[model samples]
Target: MLLLFLLVLFTQNYFSHGDLIADTCKKTEYPRICVSTLRSNPDSKTADVKGLVRIILKAALGKANTILNQANDLLKKTKDRLVRQSLNVCVSVYEEALDEIPEASVNVGTNNFEANIEASATIDIADDCEESFSNSPFTADNNAVKQLAVVAVDIIASLG
Candidate 1:
């Protein structure tokens, strides 16, 4: 029974989601990222537009959380006061983002979905964190979250 359910679920996502995912992604700024990210999630197989936003937001939140953890770890290990100050700023900004993503996710299903401000805010948050350092902190992690947030903005705008 478990195997049967798994097989059925796999086929359902494989066949049904292709066109929907492609169609939706076409309306976004980052079509490739949008398509690949949505297709990678099993829940997205049956999810509509709003559901896709939630998935993207959740992924962004996860990435931000990881970046925060990394920053915190680096903060404890580094001796430079300047780097420490920058890491502190990144940690604060990321925490702000961490709070916002959940609210954005909840707002997805509510009347405020379109009114939510995270579309540009997420990008700003990532950019702000990046700019805090002289050289740049969490290079790869910062880029990843920024890209995810960009994808989120495109798709979230489509919701409007």
Candidate 2:
């Protein structure tokens, strides 16, 4: 009987159901902790944090729209050197960021990984040049290009 019990215990250890009880217990406890931690009082600073975050997000969106409108207006109205230079700077920074994506490749063989390793290096220098610098706000001469640049500017502004 002892030997049978030992065998059962050993088999139980090997035939794991992946600790579902423990996993569920951990997941269940977190939501209770979250609910308990929420501010009980409306006047408390902790309660006000969410309100503040909303306000900040709204303000940021407003500012981005204003700036984008101003940029469009300026680009349309003037051929001023300073405005052109600032647009150029924006384009330069965008292009630099694009240049930094890693290019990679992979090789697979039918026999084994060893055979794959022996095979020639298949190069894949990703020419993402169009995607990378495709977001320049100053490149919006045509309607489609202007739309693309506006979208990029909106994306960048939202990150702030």
**Against the true structure, whose TM-score is highest?**
1
Task: Please provide TM-scores, in order, for all candidate models, with all chains considered together.
Answer: 0.84, 0.26
- Number of the top-ranking candidate, with lDDT as the measure: 1
- Look at candidate 1 and tell me the lDDT of residue 1: 100
For 38-63, candidate 2 gives per-residue lDDT tens digits of: 22223222223222222222322333
Q: Could you give the C-alpha RMSD of every candidate to the true structure, in order shown?
A: 4.0, 20.0
Runs in model 2 deviating more than 4 A are: 1-47, 87-160
Give Cα distance to truth, residue 55, candidate 2, Å.
1.2
Candidate 1: count the clashes. Answer: 0
What lDDT tens digits, residue by residue, belong to model 1 across residues 19-131? 77888788877777777788889999788888887888888888899989999999989999999999998999999999888877777767445425765577788888899
In candidate 2 the C-alpha lDDT for residue 59 amounts to 29
